[model samples]
Target: MTAPAAHAAPRIPAPPSAPADALVRLHLSESPYGPSPHALAAAHRAVDDTGTYPDPARTAPAQAVAELLGVRPDQVAVANGSDELVLLTALCLGDRQRPGVTTADTFPGYRICLENVGRGCREVPVDGIDALADAFDDAGVAYVCHPHNPTGGVLDRAAFDLLVERAAATGTPLVVDEAYLDFAPPGTPQVPDYLGTGAPVLGLRTFSKAHGLAGLRVGYAVGRADLVGRLRAVQGSMPFSVNRAAQAAAVAALADRGHLERVRRGNADARERFRADLAARGRRALPSVTNFLAVPVPDAARAERLLERDHGILVRDAGRFGLHGHLRVSVGKAADLARLLDALDIVAPVTGPGPGPALPTAATAQERP
Candidate 1:
């Protein structure tokens, strides 16, 4: 026993190669268009003062956001990213011992975050509105991704209203993720509308997607002042409070409505065109309001591999989410979609001989490369 001395365990080795830096990063949904020119300039200005710490109060950015969203500065809590906001909100509302967070099967990373914190996520299969209504009854914290991911289907307004009402009545906090809401078709309710409904709702929006500031990692949550205060307390005094550069850029980006419109229209048109092209190739793409499409294939992995290894194009394999036979492709520039279409044509060849399967075409593929 004396001979058995304590020792450090073996360490795991790193990878052999220089590391695969650009290995088909299509796994994450990201904005293809870069950040606004104004935002970029603001970020540059921020570099000038890197020696000094960012303002702890983060009042200017908060004020700009409040003005933009018709809310008070105290009602907003900015964080490193919307992902951080999601985690903080979850921690504030649900305890590890409790049921914790609830999300649909197809969400991005809510369950992963909750589970990482030794918490549980009550998953509800995302079938339709009825399923969501049935699954969200007084849950610990219900996470709803508006204009849902992967599937890209939006909850009907009536159903959304009912869900919010139910959450309010039950005193359950509903976290509505509007990360892609900026690209939603007109008439969709803004984040404030849900908060104004007297519901315990935390509306999370991010500059990562639409504003093309993913690199800056800026996102904010709006809710009742009390809830926002709770989130801020959970956030503590982080220097990441929307740095001066990101704040300046976010303000300019918000002001530059023209750029937003261009991106929105571009995404919408590309989405329809891509779906149509997939249909022509005997595949189907799920309709989406966000800047991405989910193309269904008989073999998602094969399609993804062919795109990455063969054509040098990247796409997200759905098999990781148990959604085999599908791949999520983000919309980029017109030329980018053209390249994607050409790559898909070469990779996932349509089966059967004559004229291929007859499917309802959503749009013409004349723009397809």
Candidate 2:
């Protein structure tokens, strides 16, 4: 099929803002800073003790997470990653015969996992959160990405409460992928805030983002004990999923509060700089609380390809999630962001309504982290 022509992205009223290590990646929302020194050291130490199997119950990290969340250990389930949590939630957390629900232009994993588990997925539009909330009574389960992926938008507290109330009334499960929650500003509404309501809400978090453990793939779910128990039951089928190093590192990462704070400050600095760069060049990005900004662009699918092919930079095309004309760029290291700002100026010009140079084919689907 022929690719779409380059076109001008819709502009926001003029505020803007806008990598070279192995590929200058602005994709997959990976953290700019590496893991904390404490976490890294723990992982190294744990690596040396690898002759023994990791605990099948994932006790240590689950206990650590429970303490951190002020929840019981039974309410937390550690897993290989949020991706695994998504799959497990699909497998056992709701009415198996019904379809799962989520927003359009979201992380595709919910739909993928639901379909894979024989529970089809129903996607509502970006502006339709209320609609999605209302539909929950009919759904077996629903997923919401807090500080949402691809778009980075979030619900206000009132909206979040409605979803929870509806889930409580409907007896349907609500899974909130808070994979990016650690990066959200203080007071951002999240699943944890509503856990006391006894709603069937689950928050899937990861050590991948602010903790900088993407490579280690350790994540956890914290929610109602019943939902978490279902996840743990399903998780048991894949024992030893989180390795020794990942668990030890997660425990250590939680210990080093300073490292996490530094990441928060650094991410804020990088995100604003990128936004300023884009604004200076007369472009706009969606407002975001997460570590990535969805920046408007001409033909995101092609811009994504050209950015990488021509500049050795990789960014996600928001078009992949059924949203078009934008790229979801991570708030990566400063130098890398500068490189992308320079590259994007060339690949996606600020002035025209027509498309950029045509490529032969569209970019492929990017995997969720």
Candidate 3:
């Protein structure tokens, strides 16, 4: 029998890995707070029912969301998360090769999703909607994440109305990602409130942020009945038959108006204080109505790294959004804010101790101590 030849030297290519020990994360925009106590209790209650498949239609939670927003249950379509609802909605209505789907440079994922579906996206500044009317096709769609990420600014109601009117005029569908709307200033428009205007708008909300249920992954869309049905068909049997527990918690959280108000008030106070602190320290902050503040510094990446490595406190740097001079910090409650502020003070470099011990003008350089 012939013997096998000697094997050649083996080759092992190193796998590409993310940088080691590089901030396990405050980069992801998740709530540092845990879910509500009531939501936890509901999850426990649902554990016994794990033996069975959840209802494909998810009627109960849909009803809960409907009641919360004053819309018919049929008008709502629940999903695994706001992302799911967004992708499904795009699948149902957005045509990447066509003029329908559009988003600003704010979030890349939305644009990526649209591109995946063969739809095109256009980037626009987060100003009045009037500036964006030219981008909508006669029969297309538009998507905007209000209180936009990486730049937290709310387009005024007048601008929202302009968007609705433009969409109505062009027979274009508008998908408004109000995922952070609950954290918006009070009296922000509700799902039904926008729907009542007779414009083709779909409102997306999530339990992930304000309800502190990001891990549970429950969110929904409020839209015209026909539109909701289309998304349902495109989404198939998802809406996770398992999301009931999270829904129950969301309902309870909504009912606890006092708790929600407290959370908002805390965020408001934190945002103002943080901005003021930044100003006192000679930094700029973008105006915002959401639970986060975007601060503009000279070198945001450097600042972010310095804080994480030196102080173990992290905030999101806007390098991904092309705003390399800014960072986004989520507004937390009192203690969290205090911790962040302390970290900021520790990490931010003091520029030359300002004028070096009271320089005496032209005579100062010669007489400096």
Q: Pick the candidate with the highest TM-score.
A: 2
Residue 264, candidate 2: alpha-carbon lDDT: 88
Using all chains and alpha carbons, the TM-scores for the candidates as numbered come to 0.84, 0.89, 0.81
How far in Å is the alpha carbon of 235 misplaced in model 2? 1.2
How many clashing residue pairs are found in candidate 3?
6
Model 1 stretches astray by more than 4 angstroms: 1-27, 94-96, 237-241, 353-369
For residue 224, give model 3's deviation from the true position in Å: 1.5
Clash number for every model? 0, 15, 6
Better lDDT candidate (1, 2)? 2
Top lDDT prediction, candidate number: 2
RMSD each, Å: 11.4, 12.0, 14.2
Error of 2 at 31 (Å): 1.0
Question: In candidate 2, where is summed lDDT lowest over 10 consecutive residues?
Answer: 360-369
lDDT of 1: 0.69
Model 2 earns a TM-score of 0.89
